[model samples]
Target: MIYDLLVIGGGINGAGIARDAAGRGAKVLLVEKDDLAQHTSSSSTKLVHGGLRYLEHYEFRLVRESLIERERLLAIAPHIIWPLRFVLPHDKGLRPKWLLRLGLFLYDHIGGRKLLPPTRTVDLRQPPHGAFLEDRLTRGFEYSDCWVEDARLVALNCMDARERGADIRSQTECAALIRKADSWTATLRSSAGTQQIEARAVVNAAGPWVDAVLGQSTPDKPHENLRLVKGSHLIFNRLYDGDHAYIFQNGDGRIVFAIPYERDYTLVGTTDQSFSGDPSGIAISDEESLYLCDAVNEYLKHDVSPGDAVWSYAGVRPLYDDKSSSNSTVTRDYVFELDKEGGAPILSIFGGKITTYRKLAEHALHKLGGFADRSWTADEALPGGDIGASQFAGFLAEAKQRYGWFPADGVHRLARAYGTRIDRILGDATCLDDLGACMGGDLYAAELEYLVLEEFVIKPEDALWRRSKLGLHLDRHAHARVADWFAARKEYA
Candidate 1:
């Protein structure tokens, strides 16, 4: 059996492409070498903005497409993606206020924003947003973007693809790809073993490893087409007490974002340094850490050191090598190179942001020259995202009322993680005792079972880190217990 489409890489772009193709009635198969979003997708700054900083680089088209997609994503996955107001403190040393205002104006008007509010000036000397900042910063600009559960977005797309008759395989690598006149025979390698599958076309969405994957084809093509840029972020104990985030401008013509993360921490980061190494096991450099702390210290009343960070993650962006002098100037737009040289179509994806992933998928499929004409993802909701008219908070309130016996934090966590699908995990359970073993924190046996059984969470880290941020709340003992639980399950073995 030949699949209509075979997608490589399990990040947002690949997953989204598979989902889109499957929805368009194509026989799709997506294979990921590691767990979904184990790299770049998971280690993002996690904003669904139109790349407000990209405006300075004159990336108007990318920003406009991203801004439009931002609103569409918010409408489709309201549970995972939500409006986040960002306070950009006016810094005389960096970009001028007039330039910032003009950029914000373009951003507000370009996207056709409806649900999110427009940009406005903020008084930093007042309360809440003002209290934590330095006295030198008198005023700022408040604008809206969005926060997204990056990994979950990938997972949910895979889930939707699966539901639409696409085979979504994780922990599986494409060891070899043989391109025939009309089809592709791909050798897939995993712990289980190697198997060959036929597909009519292939998508090289391997992200940082895209060129490497393309080299694996039967008649290899010389594809040195990516500028690997490392972006590192640090997680600290919550610096402020509000839901709003801060976008601080650095004196070095860069920007830093301090966002309210995970209800307990402040997520700050993203240094654009050129990276040349294995994309896996990438860590925040000492220099990068100091750079971030210094960037934030310029605005904050209280200084933050590298010691303040409890956790840090870094990812290499496989940006399209536009030959820009600085890594920061590289484009965030998606570029699709469709090669059908005496063989099946091979679409290689390069350089895309999360905000424009869905649109990227649409564009990729359109280039492939098959599938349905009508675009469906824009109006559709991701799994568990259809909360009807009441939306996320209202739906959470109703869930709490239904399960009054559950703890408030537990309910909130479950609602936020699973959204409307919490009903499947909770079932008819009226109390905590019915939730099976407590796997520490708010993680129960029921949720773990659902993750393993439904969400392709084979390894412990998949559930602990990617599927949910349970690792942050779970202690060492809990981690061990979860590992043991997965080991005990024969399916995982």
Candidate 2:
């Protein structure tokens, strides 16, 4: 079957494009070499934010667009994306208080100023601040952003795309692209075998490997548009008591965040360094770990070391290299390279953050020039995002009452993870036993079944790490149990 569009890579951008294209009535096929979000997409700092620091680089357009999408994303997927308040403290020698206020003012107003609350000043000597921060920090500003289940966002987009008739194939690699005058033939290899498929156009959204994919298509040209920047994070056992996150300004001009993570831990992170090694093999270096520790140690009342971290993750941002002097100063906005010279067109995506993926998709389709005349995904809620924007708390309350047999916290987790689709897992089950065997924590066989059947989960890691951060909450025994379940199911099949 000849598809109208073939999307390569199953990260957020690829998934978003497939979802948008399929919703526009195009015959779309999306292929990924590995499990979805197994790389950069899942390795985010987990925020739907308007790069507040980008203001210094005069990235007003990118900031504004990201800020606008921030709210839209929250409204559409309130379950996975919701508001977060960040505390930016006024330090003695770094960015001045007036400058911080100015940035916050621009941040509060630039994106049309709706839905989220405006920025406000706070005394650092107050309870939440004084208790967590150093005695030297006496004042700060609080502003809004949003948090996202990064990998889940990718899954939901692909899920919506599949539901819209797009063929979503995980663990499938496009080995070769044979372009013709009017169409292109793709050699796809998977566990089953290699097969050929045709598409009118191709989209190369391979996050870190964009250039490699482009190299395959146009072997004669050098594709060096990407500047791989590695960002790493550390998760510690609850660094603070509040739900609010802190953005600390370092003396070196970088910022680090200490956020409430996984309900029981504090997430700290993100060092920007130019990476030159294999993207897949990247991990938090000892230097990066110490840098992050020191960054947070400057502001937090209590000190922490790398040994205190419970977990760490690293992802390379596939940024568009604009010859920036520093890694942190590079643009986060996306750039598209469209090749239509010889025959069928292929659009290669470079350097986009998760916040603007939906808009990126719309622009991609428009760049391709023939998919749909009107855009439709802007107002559409992703699957299970149908719960009213402000209604998640109420939804969780009702879910707890209806599934009273389950732990209230478990119900809340499910409601947040699956949103309105929690009913699909709970169904008519009247008790915890009804859900199926407990693998560990609140994870049950029924939930795994729902993920496999609906969310394209292929392995235990996909379910534990990407589909949800249950890996952080579950024990090693539970991890082995989850693996065994997958193994048994495969054997039975």
Candidate 3:
């Protein structure tokens, strides 16, 4: 059967488009060469922010839409998305506090402003929350944004797409694409070899690799002006005691972020250096690593060393080259170029973030026109997002009361991760023993089974890194043990 729309790439944009298309009654298929979000999506700074700094570039439109969506996503996915405050320490070298305050004021009024409070002024001299700053910083600002489990966001979208009847192919690469009269046929390759798939239209949602897909699908068309830049991040043991993330202005024109991550760690990142190698050929350069560590040490009382880095990752952003002199000055907004002259239409997307993926997809699909149908995902809940027909926490409490026999922590864990879907995942389980087998660090065989039978849980790493961040919690033995088991089964391959 030919799918109505075939989307290549499983990052946030690809997954978002798949879920949206599938929900609109289209027979959709989404293919990912690597694990979903293994590239740019997961490696992001993991903030669903409005790019408050974009105001300096006069990119008000992007900031407004992003700010609006930030709040909406937080409300819908409170389990994986929640409010986070950003602390912008004032540096006389950077923009004045008045300008920053003006931007924050505009940010506060954008969208989804009903629930989250507006920005607050902070005095570094006061007690609580501001002690981490250097004494030179006498005042600062704090505002609400959102923090996302970047990898889980993709997994959740994939799960939702599957539930909505979208065919999801993970670790599957599209070898070739040919315009077959009025449709497109794609040959997909995997460890098992290759298979042919067809679709009425193809969406080139492949971040970083979008150009490669275009080359295969429409070699004649050229994106003569395109830029792929590599950004890197480092993870550290928590440096300060605060729920708020910090935004620092380096002496250079660039900026750095220090976000509280994994409850006990700080994630700082992102250097926009132009990259010309393979899109996936990304690494954290020593300059970037030291730059980040130095930026943090300049602000915090506790100094962070390269030795403090527990983990580091990199990603390439395929930004639309605008001939900007500075890489940082290049726009973070996306551009969609369509090709309908070649029988079947193809839409190629470049430069978008997780925050605006929903709108991006809607606009991209609208550009596809006849190839797509009506949009229905604006307010639809992703799979496992429906806790019940009531208040999410209340629904969880009801389930916990009913299945109170399980470890209270386990139930609360489910409530936090799966929101209202805890009941569906829990089923009739009434006790810890009922959850089947114990894996490690709150991981049980039951949850793993659910992920396998439901979401595409093939490799142990997928279960550990993507579906959950239990990698940080699971002991070495637990990781080796589960990895050995998955290798023995060889199910994911």
Q: Which of the numbered candidates is closest to the native, going by highest lDDT?
A: 2
Better of 2 and 3 by TM-score: 2
**How accurate locally, in lDDT, is each candidate?**
0.90, 0.93, 0.82
Q: How far off is model 1, as Cα RMSD?
A: 1.3
lDDT for 35 (candidate 1): 99
lDDT of 3 by residue, 1-493 (tens): 7999999998999998888887777899999998888788877888888888788898989998898777667656777777778888788878887898888898888554765778898887676545677788888888888888887788888888888899999889999999977899999998779999889999998888888998999888766556888899998888778787888888886889988887778889878888887867577988888989998888887788877899888888888888889899899998988988949999889898889988888888888876346766656666555532225567667767887777777776777677766666777776778876577767777787777777687788788877777787789988987777667556554
* Regions of candidate 1 where Cα sits further than 4 Å from its true position: 218-220, 388-390, 491-493
The per-residue C-alpha lDDT of model 1 at residue 158 equals 94
Q: Candidate 3: TM-score?
A: 0.94
Candidate 2: which stretches are off by over 4 Å? none
> Which model, 1 or 3, shows the larger TM-score?
1
Number of the predicted model whose TM-score against the real structure is largest = 2
Error of 2 at 435 (Å): 1.3
lDDT of 2 by residue, 95-214 (tens): 998899899999999999688899999999998788888999988999999999999999999999999999999999999998899899999999999999999999999999998889
